[model samples]
Target chain A: MNIFVFVKRVPDTESKIRIDHKANKIIKDGLNFVLSPYDEYAVEEALRLREAHGGKVTVFSVGADEVNIILKKCLAMGADEAVLLKDDTPETYDGLRTAKIIAKVLKDKFMDYDLLLFGRLSIGADNGQVQTMVAQLLDLPQINVVTKLEIEGNQGTAYREIEGASEKVAFSLPAVLSAQKGLNEPRYETLKGIMMAKRKEIPVLPLEDLGMSAEELAPLMEVVNLESPPPRKAGTVFEGEAEAAAKKLAQFLHEEAKVI
Target chain B: MVLVFIEVREGKVKKSSLEALSEGKRRADDLGAELHAVLIGHELDELAPECFSFGATKVHVLESTLLSQYSPSGFSRALKELVEELKPMVIFFAASSMGKDLAPRLAAWLNVGLATDCTETGIKDGRLTVVRPIFAGNVFATMVFKASPQIATLRPNVFPLVDPVDAKGEAAKKNVEITEDQVKDAVQEIMREEGSELDVTEAEILISGGRGLKGPENFNLLRELASILPRSAVGASRSAVDSGWIDHQNQVGQTGKTVSPNLYMAFGISGAIQHVAGMSSSKVIVAVNKDPDAPILKLADFGVVGDLFKVIPPLKEELKKIFAD
Candidate 1:
């Protein structure tokens, strides 16, 4: 029962953004990067919790070298392995130096892992607070965003959703959840799972060749500029009966859009 | 300075934290500094005179009982010790669900610079300049913060909550020591959840629907015109909540819930930029949509092309005959 997950590569959230004027930022030429639509619901909820609790699912990222083509597309949506923490100008929308470089590249693989997953925010910084800030710098036990998950033996639970209800929360078995885009519906990779993810295996490292440091994960907070916005002004067509245009749109929401 | 956290929950105050306390008193009076706010949980002295009627010149208070249910690592360690003793410049919070889980760990323990959900803000020579809408609003990003304690998270009814241009609650606060043993995220109880009472941005009327309201029991005809208006609330879109016909918290655009209510009424909804990023700062967006070129009718301000079962039961019988005359 290992898990890990954590993905990232961003910038293709339909990239039409520009703003580089000498590195003020976000002009990453042409765009098209992927693998972060909220980490495909945390790599499909860690491949459906290792296909209903059996074991194995790994995955990690820091990116660049085109994040090995989105970690082989999360090894074709099943993830039994992959690491990729390369880093070369991997300024990754700086969410706390990308969660202190995924907590210093998983601080000694967090005691061989028991569970750690993210993706409840990150369309390149939608900020779902980095899997509870890497479970608060590895102090652990975080259940955030969830949307559902179970497990029994070591007691897990999850659920989350918050703000208009849905909590559940139970935590125990080496936690850290996050995952949230409706929590499931991810899949998409078939063709016999893309011919068995073209023979699995993803590895690749370089957090100072695994020893780590880039100022032990730099970035206090950046992105001085990234731009793209300014185009919203043409609207005013209220014609005909839908109850007489809801009465001149209820009198333009009450006298020239005063909003009732 | 600007600290504004204020999220009260079942005890009042949270019309998006009074638009994050009037955008943290307009970014602390646009950097002339000082505006505080903060209010964590518990009885909160009746939402502290409505955070001094929304100009919170100052008002720290951390009200405990482990801040009665809710612990994003104990509200980001009581806002990272009041942002290390109020080193604010900007720190709005209220992207909801507890400022999207305590504004990125209080901007990663005050290292600074953050821009979440934002949806427009400006300051200029003193920085702040926010505006955020990505992927779900189809793109619009404009950020900045070279530091000076800049942190944002707004996006709840996109600003508009003034009231006390500073009548009393003057500038000068203190009480903020927090305990429950300086929580590290342990609420061992409360899984309680009773939600559902139309609060899409404090609903001032909203009755959304989409995918032509063909399933999930036609969302009770958009909840019968949101139980007959008077601060309505029903919403849908994201193709009727991914076609389950509703319940993705009654979805709405841009990854849902960005409502600007005051009359949104979109039925058989066709709009999609994730539902116009949750309502295009709504306020009169009426779109009925029989497909008069549906892109939520270019952010409607009024465009009933036609047919939500003949336009919502005669506009819910003309709003129950004008609130019964």
Candidate 2:
């Protein structure tokens, strides 16, 4: 089984995001970047599949040169190789253009893969569109938010969490599956793994190499404006004995909220 | 025409889809276009009238055994075909699990732009603009789609449902074509959570706990409180679910479940933006945490600084008394 996983570098969840009003962009200074949490699960699932099925796992990402740090982390987690599709444009591409680029690369450059893995969604954009878009672009069956998966021969069965229920789906091979939480616990990189990762070389592919032009990758949607959500009005905060606080809370709920 | 996808399960239209229909109706009226609804499921002919009452000028019905359960390929293909024939200026879908999975595929197949989890939408300069929360709920970005037939998935509960009115004499119903072979992915079964009631997305009141509860056993206190509140459901932060304190189905956060309950009460949850994104739209928010500066308190309408163990027991007792009265 040849498994390919797509990873993205996003701001750490705990990082404080500041919008640069003048520039109309997020200020990246003084911010920490990490492999998207959901992508870590995707990389881990790929490694586990490779270990069980006796094949190589290659990690791929679409970003600038700074994404090498995240690719190295994937290598440390037992991926056999890494590929970075360097975006020439300064602006972020929408899901359609991004998926098109990835699909082109997979179809024209790395054609050996039998399965593709992706995080359910990236926290930055939070659009959760690329994986499904990639599946559609490639005409491959796809499942999103998969929590449990099993594979045998050329068929796969996946369990995905829906609103109040779970669904069991069966699909053919060469499919795209997005990893959700509870799929499996990702293993941390060891000292030896980290040392080995430093020695691994990641090839950065340019848009020209993938037969794509800058204009072809332009975003379909334009950002009009961005603003911080208005702060909630200050409310009464009780600081007293547990009983008094509870009594106060009950009174507020009944009188103000009126849910009771 | 502006088209809205009316999601149905077990032969009933979903509340979120109704909200989407209401949004679609508003946009259609604004654009002076007809509002159309698409219903896909087995035995959904009976539910088509609900769409008309919700302001659909026309209803498109596609019934097939293959569509009884949602398959991304199946639904997207059918919808794509219908969309091509209809040539709608805008399409609306509820940002439920099925919509989130299907909308992107349809957008990609049509080579159009899609905005997901939109809290607000409107027409500007004869184009569709959507406002969606990013970085969880800390920042809001307004986006405009340059492509024709713009697609958007509206967050549930954000839009008001249209007041029920008499059906405008049965909407013009038309049947779309879809064959079983078009559905590539097969669903073996849909396993529902045993003895679970009120999914967080639809719950009117939610009582959520975080890691401060100390252990999974402590969730019983939340359950006891929930039992007394009508239509209330239990929710957990990602931290609690990650720590195995509760099932992921009950998780309320960016990656878990986005909800807008009538009232949301957080216990020991430090309001992470991820958690806040899911429930910040609650009509009323109450928080209890030992730390005064927990992020959730900033968003709550009422806050208490105390240990949850001490506060919850008494709070539940007080709530029982108030409700009893």
Candidate 3:
């Protein structure tokens, strides 16, 4: 078995997000970048699968040069190899364009892989479209938001959470699966693993080397403007004993809000 | 034609689909095009009338046992055939789990652009433009599609479901073709959580907790409150779910569930943007936290600065009294 995992670098969840309205983009200065939290689950699941079934885990990411930091983290946590699909252009926001580039690379280079893994959704764009698009491009079976998975021989079973139900689905080998929460607990990188990762070299693949031109990778959608959400005004705040506040709240619900 | 996919579960239409229908109808009127709906499921003949009442000019029904449950390959192939024949100007889907899974695959199959979880949609300069949240709902991105039959998935509860009005034209039903072999992924079973309790997305009132609750045992406080309120459900922030204090199904956030309950009450939640993206569309929000500066309080319609342990018990007691009377 061979596993390929896609990782993304995003601002830490705790970091404050600021929008540059004048430039129609997010302010990247002074923000801490880390591996997307959900992708950590994917990386960990890949390592576990390697342990269960003899295989090598290759982690892939597409971004600027700074994305190597996240690739190193994945390597330290047990990924056997890291590849960076470099995209330094301004048109990287289009999910389909990104998916097309990845599908091209996968087809040209790693077509023999048995499985592809991805986070259920990237926290930064929240698009959740690229992995499925890639699966379609590859014409392979795919499942999203999988909570539980089991593989035996050439077949695999996955459980995905729906609105109020869970669907148990089975597919053959050479498939795409997105990791949801509860898939597994991501382990922290150990000292020995970190030291070992320092000796590994990550290969960067540029679009030019992949024989893709800028016209082919151009985005279909343009960002009209980027703005912060309208500030939510502070509503009336009550300060008093718990009982009095509760009474006032109940009154407000029944009278003003009329929700109760 | 502007086509909207009417999602059905257990032989009934979903509220999110109704919302998408309403939005699609508005967009169709703006474009002076007919609004059509497609229902793909088993035993869906009875569900077409509701689609007509909700403003579908024509309802397409593709009934097959293979589509009784969602399979990416089956539904997308069925819809792809319909889309290729109709050549619709736009397509709409609810950004639910099933819709999120199906829309992109269809878009990729058709080689078109797709926007997911769109909060707003309209026609600009003779092209469709959609607005969606990015960076965990902290920033909004407005996007335009470059191809015809542009596809978009709408966030549930973001659009209004207007009253069912009489249709101008009778809804014509058309049968679509699908084969069992088209569905590559076989469904072994669909296990629903054993209960009659409403899920968070379907609940009208939601009481959610965060790490501030101290521990998993404290979730009982929220369950107690939920029991007292009508059609209420308990929810948790991602931190609580990550801490193993609650089930992921009960988690409400960017990665979890996006809910727009009638009233959302947060207990000890600091209101991270990821969590806010899920529940910000609720009709009204009330926050209770010890810290006066919690981000949730800023978005809440009402705030009480106090310890949740002290406030929740009394609050539940007061609500129980009112209901008893």
Q: Which candidate is the best by lDDT?
A: 2
lDDT for each candidate structure: 0.70, 0.87, 0.86
Cα lDDT tens digits, model 2, B196-303, are 677888778899999988899999989999998998889999999989999988998776777888899999899886788778778899999999888787788999
Native-vs-model 1 lDDT? 0.70
Per-residue error (Å), model 2, residue B230: 2.4
Please say which candidate is ahead in lDDT: 2 or 3.
Answer: 2
- Per-candidate Cα RMSD to the true structure, in Å, reads 20.8, 1.8, 2.0
Worst 10 residues of 3 chain A by lDDT: A87-96
**lDDT over C-alpha atoms for residue A9 of model 3:** 90
lDDT of 3 by residue, B1-325 (tens): 8999998877679989999999998999889988989988777777788888888878888767777777888888889988999999999999988899999999988878888888899997767889988776777888888787889999887788979986554544555466666787656687888652678987889999999999999999999998899988899999999899988899988778778888999998999877997888788899899998888888899999888898888888889988998
With candidate 3 superimposed using the best TM-score fit, by how many Å does residue A243's alpha carbon deviate from the native?
2.1
Per prediction, fnat is: 0.35, 0.80, 0.73
Who is ahead in TM-score, 1 or 3? 3
For all candidates, state DockQ relative to the true structure. 0.13, 0.72, 0.67
Sort the candidates on TM-score, descending order: 2, 3, 1
Question: Against the hidden reference, what TM-scores do the models get?
Answer: 0.35, 0.96, 0.95
Output DockQ, candidate 1.
Answer: 0.13
